[model samples]
Target: MPDLNWQKSSFSQQASSCLYLAAAPDGTVKLRESDNPDVILTTAPATLGALIRGIKAGEFDHIRTA
Candidate 1:
């Protein structure tokens, strides 16, 4: 994964227990939490975009609220 330039969220401060992302040459995106880098979530850009949109719309807020 050396070529995978992992990037963290800008919102992450000094204690960066945030999500990290990396893109592969094949166009697949990988996501992982800084606290557990070993576990990765692989998905397409479209799916990721939907997730981001849902997040922005607070559609998944029920998960946290529940």
Candidate 2:
């Protein structure tokens, strides 16, 4: 994770400031809010891709309400 470049989601608003990203060197994907960089959640490449697809397909719409 030496050269990892963390990027926030394009959909993240300035107010929310959530960080969502895919990291190289191991192809691991991670999600963490910009306000809290110390706490990161990681997932395998395949699962990460699937979750991204689900989000794009509106499978996580409940998150908006919660």
Task: Give the best candidate by TM-score.
Answer: 1
For model 2, the superposed segments whose C-alpha errors exceed 4 Å read 62-66
Error of 1 at 56 (Å): 0.6
The segments of candidate 1 whose C-alpha lies over 4 angstroms from its true place after superposition are 63-66
Per-residue lDDT of candidate 1, residues 1-62 (tens digit)? 55788898788985448889999788999999988888999999999999999999998777
Ten-residue stretch with the least lDDT total in model 2: 15-24
TM-score for candidate 1, please give it: 0.81
| Residue 7 lDDT, candidate 2, scale 0-100 | 80
Q: What is the lDDT for 9 in model 2?
A: 59
User: At residue 51, what lDDT does model 1 achieve?
Assistant: 92
Which pairs clash inside model 1? none
Please report, in order, the local distance difference test score of every candidate based on alpha carbons: 0.87, 0.74
lDDT of 2 by residue, 1-66 (tens): 565677875677783577757476666776677777778888888997787799999997774443
